[model samples]
Target: MSNFKITDIVGVIPALITPFDENENFDEGRMRNVVDFLIEEGVHGFYLTGSTGEGFLMTPDERKKVVKVVVDQVNGRVPVIAHIGAISTKISIDLAKDAYETGVDAISSVPPFYWKFKDNNIFKYYEDLSGSTPLPMIVYNVPLAGLFGFDFIKRLSTIENVKGIKYTAYTHQDIHKAKAQIGKDFMVYSGADEMAVSGLFNEADGIIGSFYSMLADVYVDIYNNIKAGEFSKAQIKQKIAVDIIEASLKYDYYAVIKAAMKWMGFDGGYVRRPFNNLSSCEEEKVKDEFRKIRDRYGVEDIRVLKSI
Candidate 1:
């Protein structure tokens, strides 16, 4: 019966992956299983249909279905933030409206890709999208969408419904500066999974990353360790996190994450076209390597991870 407020949107929020069946259709059951898995693992929140979820590649209908299924499966256990960003303001608005009506706790968006829009144009895109719904908006700043400069980020913080920014850059100073410039009430979720310890130590309220779908407990451990003022222990956990991340990156990222999940008995089915899942031989190789990573990091099962 508990629900999270904007201020409560902190800690290990997984950047959830979009599961597809062998036929490349949205596998609702597998998606639902992923939702339930994260919840049981004690994730603090869920970011649906973001980069990790392949939102950009999905049709509007697929995106909506994902949001609906995740929100329904989550059933108010924690906050569900949907990523509704698209190539144009109109599409983003439509997706935003759908996400809002589908009962997401909030909406987040990356800037328009494949074009060099001026700063004002980019600002207007977010402004228009934020105005499309009452749901709070978190600006997603990643390299692919053009990095959001501090000036632009500061301007965005002033937007009426703009709640926060998902900082994905390599610098921890950006997190610190955003907090100082935007004021403490504005939430900043570290989108880089490997830098979670740095983000938390620099005062990021939470973390949202693709890796967390399988590694939630370890990130939660880092969060808790940092919050408890156990920096030494948190540093050790962060090292473990980086190690896991490095292992996953050796292959196709989404493919590797999905394969790792599959290895743990969760249904991370084939990735859609334009991005292929591991072949039989590659899967066997990656699985053998991941097993070592898992054993070293103590990643047994998602369901067994201690909850926050």
Candidate 2:
């Protein structure tokens, strides 16, 4: 049998932020705490080493260390989806294999960037990575990366081990089109934190996002409240989440979140250099706004993951 398809595990999958210590080294202690915090905050699992985690910024070795820290902490309590995209297929394959050996539940990869490739090249990329390990692979489609569109996804999704997609942002129509093409059992994870409600409403099985670094419960509550048929509550929470995203963008996004993690006592450490730190000026404004997001979403300071 193929490794577990994503539907077997779903919801509030946070693309984790990489924690860095003063030396610009990966901070294992802080990384573990962040994983624990998300698990406790009702996040179902982790989507590691993505844009939020600065996966693109890290060396291959650093990426492996980050994945190891998370898998080691998660143990069996939650599923972990490791993102292994890099400039080379070899590095991506090695990372996918390493994550599988280290005990991650699944893996996803963004389409290769920098050197734009034809559909055939994207096809081969997924073919190679999925074949590299039995782990169910989700093709990450981030147009912002300038590497993806529907044709590429349709081609990649056919790989036997390729189970689904984690699309950066798509209209309900776009998802509908994908739904028709990918067919049953191939999960579609929503990438736009802003579009979670609409995606889940249209039947997306899960979510993979950078915003979940701080807004874990907001994402969860929106889904739970909707499934519970509490539409009013769900909409209110989603609005709060969007507001948080807006405020987060206003501040330095990573800086605001690293600061939030520290405030919550999770030791989220700091965003590595080249990403820069969130300015103290924006930080002051964001804290107040963040409090609003927390209150609006009905996420308690201490929470637990709902049984998936």
Candidate 3:
């Protein structure tokens, strides 16, 4: 059985961006660097192969490789929650087993999407997948998938080993209600990057989002400030984060994130195919905007941008 309790997965957990090579291949070396960089920046845990990681774009084997590399690199320094959600129960089960063997602290899955499965079917999916491995199970409640509701979450929570929910919707009210109804033992990580401050104030156990991968220290500060009752300080950081996100949203989200990381001196390569890449001119514009945001917000000067 997994030694990690639900509480161990709390705090600023980044839904990591999967690094790729020019040929769109998974780059192990770059992946390790991303992992090490985030750990050094003080993130509490990692959620691998999720939407931000382009989990659905890669083959199952590629996903497994990514998880193995991260788990090996992490070396138990912090908890690693592998996103093994697939449309098929068998596939998710297989991935969960592999995640257990690879030593992840927990496993999470987006309820099977693409088909309009009923609540019962969804519950069955969680039941089989969570029971397949001893690792703590975190249900990914992404409303965009159209399968999420508080009632569904409560039902899933009853499953053996199902311990938490990565609540990715914008409804902070649901987060507050879940905490009150589900009890503190059920971990509810706020998965909306733009709402980090609101989520925490509403009683989310922690924050997990795509932006956290790019701005780990900033979000870490936000979490710390809130915990310390420094609401004003946390709001300042959250505003900076919002500004960055607004700028990036003007371009292809994944492409611009990779581009920004490159400008920061960490070349995470490009977003994989089926996702558009930023043109040369577009890349430069994004770089300029990002630099301005960084300077305006006084984002820490640890990156190579200071020298540039």
Candidate 4:
């Protein structure tokens, strides 16, 4: 049987960033605090080691460490989806199996990149990894992975235990078509942080985003508003998120977030090598704008929420 029931996965799941120390090592303490903060904020689920989490940069051992830390910290309060994508099929399968054993609610992977392959090969990659673990597998489809379109999604969705796709693009019509073709139960999570409400309008089951790590309450508000048939309110929340995201893009996006987390009194550490940390001047600007974001949104001081 599949490890994760389809209904168990939904809503504003944050694609959590990995906390790293000055020495460029994973910082467990910082990670724990972030997890506690997110759960306390009422985020529906957690997505670890994805693009925003720098999963692509981490070694297999490092990825496993992240999974263990997050899963233990969460302790079944909500679902945790682990992204275990590697360029090699064997590595992806091994990571999938390891994440399953480490207790993630589901596993996700990006298609093979930096090399050309037939559609059949891509399908085989997902097919092998999906069967390697009972945990449901989510396909990460973005332009970076060649944007497996709706028809391909229909085929991929047929894989045993392949539960869904983290649809990262803005093609809402295709998302609508895929849902109609495959039936409503096939999960479609919006990975595009900016157009989140649009995704839901097109019938995405929920949203999984990196920005939600900081503005989860806003995203959750958007989700709840949509569910309550409050489209206008949902659009308002979406605009707030877009504004914050626009501000975050001012510098290195991940670096800005790490800086923002620190400003909020959470233990957001540093980004690893090759991804430059923000310069001091840029960081101050981000902090200044982040405060504006909170002010504009009328959000409470999240730092006062108390860390676990």
What are the lDDT scores of the predictions, listed in order?
Answer: 0.83, 0.78, 0.86, 0.85
Candidate 3's displacement at residue 106, Å, is 0.6
Instruction: Provide the global lDDT of candidate 4 against the true structure.
Output: 0.85
Q: Between prediction 1 and prediction 4, which has the larger lDDT?
A: 4
Q: How close is each model in CA RMSD to the real structure?
A: 3.0, 3.8, 1.9, 2.8
Q: Which lDDT tens digits does candidate 3 get at residues 92-144?
A: 99999998999899999998999999888999999999889888899988876
lDDT string for model 4 (109-223, tens) is: 9999889888999999999999998888889988777898677899999999888889998888877887888878778899999999999899898899988887777788889
lDDT of 4 at 17: 93
Q: Model 1 has how many clashing residue pairs? A: 0
The regions of model 3 sitting more than 4 angstroms off are 1-3, 294-308
In terms of TM-score, which candidate is stronger, 3 or 4? 3
Clashing pairs in 2: 42-305
Number of clashing pairs per prediction, in order: 0, 1, 0, 0
lDDT of 2 by residue, 8-46 (tens): 778888889998987778989888888888898888888
- Return the candidate ranking by lDDT, descending: 3, 4, 1, 2
